[model samples]
Target: MNGSVTSQDLGEIFKPIVESFGCELWGIDFNNSGRSRLLRIYIDKTERPIDVKDCEKVSRQISGVLDVEETISGDYVLEVSSPGIDRPLFSIDQFKMYIGSKISLKSRIQKEGRRKFNGVLKKVDAQNIEVEVGKVDYVFPHSNIESANLISDY
Candidate 1:
């Protein structure tokens, strides 16, 4: 899969299958690396942590579905796993959940001469999020965030 295959597209195709196994589709990461593409599906459960069996079960189900659907253009590795403690933040709601927690993120475009930010997520509203990096507070539009992950202090 190339640029044509989006995370959203794959998420739509795989979310139902993931949910069927009593887990939530935390996020999907599709990396197009020339001939060797990698597709990673992150699964989560509110009550407890996901185990190897959960990963195996979801992997099998998704593998079968992908084989049948043929949505991808070429050969790719499919990995199903939990979004660990340093889990990626994909949506605004996901960010909201981490309020007052530390996060490391990269912005698509530089803001105030900086594109990278590592600090506590101070606030989240409808359009933007505030991060307190050092003593300065920076407000970044949600759309500008290229990638964000919760910081595992441990």
Candidate 2:
């Protein structure tokens, strides 16, 4: 699969493999950068912090599966690592988990005459999320958000 494959499909393909090793499949980012594509998978565990060993294990296992199944074509980098402090939020559930935390995001459509926003994540439900940017509260639909990540100042 090239750029045609959706991240959700990739997530379904990898979630079992990631969870088998006792980790949550945080998200998958499939980027087509000119000649080469990038498939970055973020993994996390509820019990402990992820380390190089965790990444290595996941990469090694996932690489074997991908090779055997031919899930991806062309030269692409397969990265399996932790989301780090500034973890990219991919789903509403992920957004819910980070409520009350600082976040920065860019919307696909303009909101309030701007596309970029930085604020404390105040609320997250099924359809949208409310973020407090200073004194203003901005609501962004799940579909409108292009990219979002936690902001860890510490």
Candidate 3:
């Protein structure tokens, strides 16, 4: 793909590949920073926990496809793995799934005079999610979220 390719574009491209392996494409994180670039793909399986074999299988397929499609320019490391316990939340559906769980998120822009929030996920809707930090509930539009991740109870 081109430099302009968004995460959503990569998601659309890989969703089918991931599904063919009997897995769900949980999310994709592409970090292009400094001299190195990293493309991280998180996959999930409903039936069982993901293992190294699964990651290797998906990695091989994705690597081949990326090579043929030139999906990413220049040198980049491709990593395929599970989201883990402190899984990063990518979609609104993910947030919905983790309702009532502790989460921390960073917004692209300051909301209520803060860009970072650590709280209990109270509610999720189509457009927004409510997180209670301390006793105050904060509503954040989905578009404003830069990154969010569950706070592992462990």
Predicted structure with the largest lDDT when compared to the true one: 3
| Global fold similarity of model 3 (TM-score) | 0.96
Q: Estimate the TM-score of every prediction.
A: 0.93, 0.94, 0.96
Q: 72-136 in candidate 3: lDDT tens per residue?
A: 78888999999999999999899999999999999999977789999999999999999999999
Q: List the residue pairs that clash in candidate 3.
A: 1-71
Best by TM-score: 3
C-alpha lDDT values of all predictions: 0.91, 0.92, 0.93
Window of ten residues with lowest summed lDDT in model 1: 1-10
TM-score of 1: 0.93
Candidate 2 residue spans exceeding 4 A from truth: none
**On a 0 to 1 TM-score scale, where does candidate 2 land against the true structure?**
0.94
RMSD, each candidate, Å?
Answer: 1.6, 1.3, 1.0
Candidates 1 and 3, the one with greater lDDT: 3
lDDT of each residue in 1-154, candidate 1, tens digit only: 4348889999998999999989999998888668888999999999999999999999999998788777887888999989999999988899999999999989999878889999999999989999999999999888888889999989
